[model samples]
Target: MTTPVLFIHGLCLHASSWDPWIQLFRDAGYDPHAPGWPGDGATVEASRQHPDAIGDHGIDDVVEHFAGVIDRLPSPPILIGHSFGGMIAQKLLGQDRALAAIAIDAAQIKGVLPVPLSALRATLPVFRNPANLHRAVSLTAEQFRFAFANTVSEQESDELHERWTIPAPGKPLFEAATANFDPHSPAKVATDNQTRGPLLLIASGKDHTVPESVTRATLKQYRHSEAVTDLVTFPDRAHSLTIDSGWREVADTCLTWLKQQSL
Candidate 1:
């Protein structure tokens, strides 16, 4: 089946982040759609002052919101999500929805381990102060380069920062940091290899937030789907692999992976 694709962006990024992948999916004859988190329509500067707009939003809220979109779509689309968006995708799989899913730069889900060193380092400024809960924490160009743009050069990093960096919800960061990924954790979603459709994990070659080891750790959670579970890493890329300079290769890899499967 020719499955439609929905691109769920990560924290601090808007739907615009997937601009590179939009046409690629369309050209491949797969429909691509991008939707923002509620209250994300505002520009980055505005969100910095009023983080509450998206602060109260939860994973289930996102899942149901997207489910409504899927319900109205031409078909049960394939899910393509990044970081926090990947968390959203994992929750959807618990519901046993969608045709297939690709989680790019995903955060840890319940039953999966959290190698929080990188993530905590990246998010320390935000969580270190409770007062920052309702505000946007400014990340310097250097900080952004280290946390997110390491693989990409300074020029590209500055450009990407200018073009894509935005205020994100602090609440989710705090919750993910401490939320015990247990059966009772509100963020926990019970997705085995079976409930989720053909699942693929895309890792950036130099992604600091979600390292290769962290991604590999996620594999153990869905051993039942080992028959179909797949992984590919772009060694020269960073966390924003979906929109980086070599993003076409990333998109093509997903396309190639999709074509090989019978979904």
Candidate 2:
């Protein structure tokens, strides 16, 4: 049977942003799918026009949403996720719901201690308002440039913002921000699962939203697990490494990693 792959997109980017990856993975003989988060509209424009539909969803809600998707698959899939989607991928993988997982510039999970100033600034648009926790928020192109496309050219950043950005729930951001304090935080992943499938975390050094230090901290969370856990760094890339002009390079790296794992 052909191995299945599921691509999970992060906040601000639409599920269609994975179109290129889906096609590429398909050509590589894998069945790939990219599903939107719960409450996402059918299209980016539609999502923009109806932000309420995308608001109020927290981290647990998203985890259950993707878990349902996994339940319907013929077999466990190899998960590849970017940003918030990366965190979701890790959660599902920890639950042993995937064959394997690759988390790219993943959001901070429970037990991750370093909250870099850049990460705080990247998420400030949402955290600025206490009420935003229950609302959907959209980033200005400037904020997008700072948080995601900082490593890319100005023109490319603007174009990417226009093409792929959408409003996303602030709940998950708030939840993640306070995860370390909450003993039962939804951001918690079963990092100690000794029998789970392999996990590869891809961190971008220039990422403002999830810095390399944060990824390194996340790696330490799995120190107790004998299961395969690996980390790779792209020293000059930013969070947009998955969707910017350099996206193919990141995707190719993931493909190569999978091959190395014999998946």
Candidate 3:
């Protein structure tokens, strides 16, 4: 039987962002589903039109939303996530939920030190306004280009922005930034858990949002884990590695890894 796959999207993107990824995995014989964050609309148009629906939602809500989806599946699915979605994949794995997981240019979590300058710049729109913490935030095309598509051409970056970018909740950003200071913060992950399934962390060398350094530090935290944990770097890619024209390369790499795990 084909294994089930779940594609989790990042901040400022709707589930539709994974449409191509869903098709790729389906062609590879996997049953795939891309569920949006709580209150995120059912479609990109809906999400864009009703940004308020996703406002004020935090990371814990997102983790539980995906967890519920996993619970209802016939079997544990392969969890694949990007950016903030990658953080969700890690949280689920910490709970020993997925059969295997992939985190691509994942956002930083607690214990990750020395926040990257680019990452901070990328998140400035949200943190700049204190009131944004309780509201939905949208990014300008230029901001999106800088954070996600710097490695791609201007026209392609604009195309990516029109197709995938959308308003996202700002609460999660505040939560992640303050997680280390809060003992009960939901952004904390149990990296030492022995049962966390085989995990792969993919880093994009040119990514401005979640750089290689953050990914390496995240991997370091898992060094004590008994589970199989690996890291791979795509030197020419940016944060848009999973959505840009060269997404197939990232997908193929993941498919190869999944097959190696015999999932």
Candidate 4:
């Protein structure tokens, strides 16, 4: 049987972020399912009107939401996620939920331990507003430049800032910031489990959010599964590699990985 694919979007964005990848996967002969977070809207525009959405969504909430989508599917679906979605994917893997996975510029993997200035700056505005705890704060143009468009052109950066950047839950960022505080952080990505199946971690060398060192450190956490834990870095990419210019390359890489592991 063909293994279905679960394409989970990152924090703030909805399932619509998978539109391009979804169509690409279809051509590759795999089923793709993308799910929205609990308070997410059906469309990006609709989501904007409700600025309070995603503010309180925690890692557990995102995990359960993705698991719910996987449960309704025929069987365990190959999970692919980005950013916060990537953290949720690792959480799902700990439960032994799926057979294979691919994470693109995923944030906060088990061994990843770096907080770049850019990431901190992009997140500062969220923490600045205490009300952001109960309401999502859409990314401003400057914030987008720091977090998602660091590697793109000025025009492209502005376009991305307008099109895709939206209010996101501050809870995930807050939790990620605190991961180093407690030894038993619930938000820590679980990569030590060897039975988690084939997995790939794709990092954007240019990504300020998930730095190369962070993703590399994450590999050590899965040292036992050296063969299954694959890592790739897009030298010219940023945090928004999936949507950045030349995204087709990233999409193609993901499709190829899925084919090798699933098909």
Candidate 5:
């Protein structure tokens, strides 16, 4: 039987953002599934029209929600996640819930320090609005372009914004940002769990949200782990590496890596 794969999207985007990736992995003979955030609208248009559907959710809610999906699978999945979803993949791996994992341009967990200026700028929309902590936040085309599609063409960026962008709960962002000080935070991940399966951290060179530097720092945090941990850097890609016109290239790269692992 083919091993199941779960594709998790980052904030402000729905599961459909992984449509191309799902098709690519399916063709590669993996049973791929992409589940949306809790209460997410069924489509981008619906999400944009009704932001409250995804409002007020925090990291724990999302982690538990995805865990339920994982539990229903026939076997522990090969987890693949982007942005905040990437962080959840790491958390699940720590819990011994995945066979192997791939995190692409993933958000940082508790121990990752040295927040980059670009990353901070990208969060300004949510951070600047204190009320956003309890509400969903939507990105304008300009903000989306600056954060995820800066390296793509303007036309493509606009199209991406129109097709995939939606409101995201700001609670997760707040939780992640203040994790270091929150003893009960859900943003923490056990990087040293020897039981954790192999993990591949993919970094986009031009990503303003999760920079290569941030990825390198995240990789360093797991140096003491006995499990196999790897980092792959795409020097020309941005945060939207998984969805841009060059998405097939990223998908092929991940497929090739997984094949090498015999996954």
Candidate 6:
């Protein structure tokens, strides 16, 4: 049977952003699918037209949504997730729901203590207003440039923003921010699952939204687990490494790692 692969996108980018990955994974002898988060419309324009449908969902809600997707698969598939999607992949993998997972520039989960100034600034569009906690928030082109496309050229960044950007629920950001304080925070991941599948955490050195410091701290969270866990850093890449022109390099790196694990 062909191995299955699921691509999970992070906030502000439509699930369609995984289109290139889906095709690439398929060509690599895997069956790949990229499903939108709950409340996401069939298309980016549809989601934008009705922002209310994309608001109010929280971290746990997203985790559960993807878990349901996995339940219908022929078998537990490999997972590749970016940003908040990375966090969701970790949560599912801890539950022993996948064969393996790759989390690229994942958001900070509970117990990850370093919140850099850049990260704070990147998420300021949502945190600046308490009301945003329950609403859907959209990033302006400039905000997207700073937070995700900083390492890329201005023209390319603007084009990407127009192509993939969408309104994202603000609840996950709020939950992650207060996770350390909430003992039962939805942002918590089962990092101690020794029997869970192998996990690879990818970090981009110049990612303002999810700084390398955050990814390193996240790696520490898995130290108690004896399961296969590895970290790879792209020293000059930014948060857009997974979507920008450099995406193929990151994807190829992931493929190489999976082969190393004999997966």
Query: So what's the TM-score on candidate 1?
Result: 0.89
Q: 157-256, model 6: which lDDT tens digit per residue?
A: 9999999989999999999999999999999999999999999999999999999999999999999999999999999999998889989999999999
Better of 2 and 4 by lDDT: 2
Question: What lDDT score goes with residue 154 in model 2?
Answer: 97
* Candidate 3 residue-wise lDDT, 1-263, digit = tens: 66889999999988998998899899989999998999988887888998889899999989989999999998989999999999999999889899989999998889888698999999999999999988999999999999999999999999989988889999999998998899998889889999779999999999899999999999999988889999999998999998889999999999999989888
Candidate 2: residue pairs that collide: none
lDDT of candidate 1 over 1-263, digit per residue (tens)? 55689988877676787877888898888888987776676565555556567665655567788888789888888888998888777667657677888888787666666565776677776778896655545567777777788887889988877777776767566566555644456467555545457788887767887777667777677775543678787777778677668778878888888888764
Which one is best on lDDT? 6
Q: What TM-scores do the predictions have?
A: 0.89, 0.99, 0.98, 0.93, 0.98, 0.99
Candidate 4 global CA lDDT score: 0.77
Model 5, 218: alpha-carbon shift in Å?
A: 0.3
Q: Write the per-residue lDDT of candidate 4 for residues 186-218, one digit (tens) a residue.
A: 687666676677888888887877777677777
Error of 3 at 219 (Å): 0.3
The weakest ten consecutive residues by lDDT in model 4 span 109-118
State the lDDT of candidate 5 residue by residue for 99-130, as single tens digits.
98999999988988879999999999999989
lDDT at residue 34 of model 1 (Cα atoms): 89
lDDT for residue 110 in candidate 4, whole number 0-100: 38
For model 2, state the Cα shift of residue 97 in Å.
0.4
lDDT of each: 0.74, 0.94, 0.92, 0.77, 0.92, 0.95
Tell me the spans in candidate 5 whose CA falls farther than 4 Å from its real position.
none
Choose 2 or 6, whichever is better by lDDT.
6
The list of candidate 2 runs beyond 4 A from truth reads: none
Alpha-carbon lDDT of model 5 = 0.92
> Could you tell me how far off, in angstroms, the CA of residue 200 lies in candidate 2 after the best superposition?
0.4
Q: What TM-score number comes out for model 6?
A: 0.99
RMSD of each: 2.4, 0.6, 0.9, 1.8, 0.8, 0.6
Task: Point out the higher-scoring one by TM-score: 4 or 6.
Answer: 6
Q: For model 2, how does the per-residue alpha-carbon lDDT over 1-263 read when each residue is reduced to its tens digit? A: 88889999898899999999999999999999999999998899999999998999999999999999999989999999999999999999999999999999999999999999999999999999999888999999999999999989999999999999999999999999999899999999999999999999999989999999999999999999999999999999999998899989999999999999999
Q: Indicate the residue-level lDDT of 212 in model 5.
A: 94
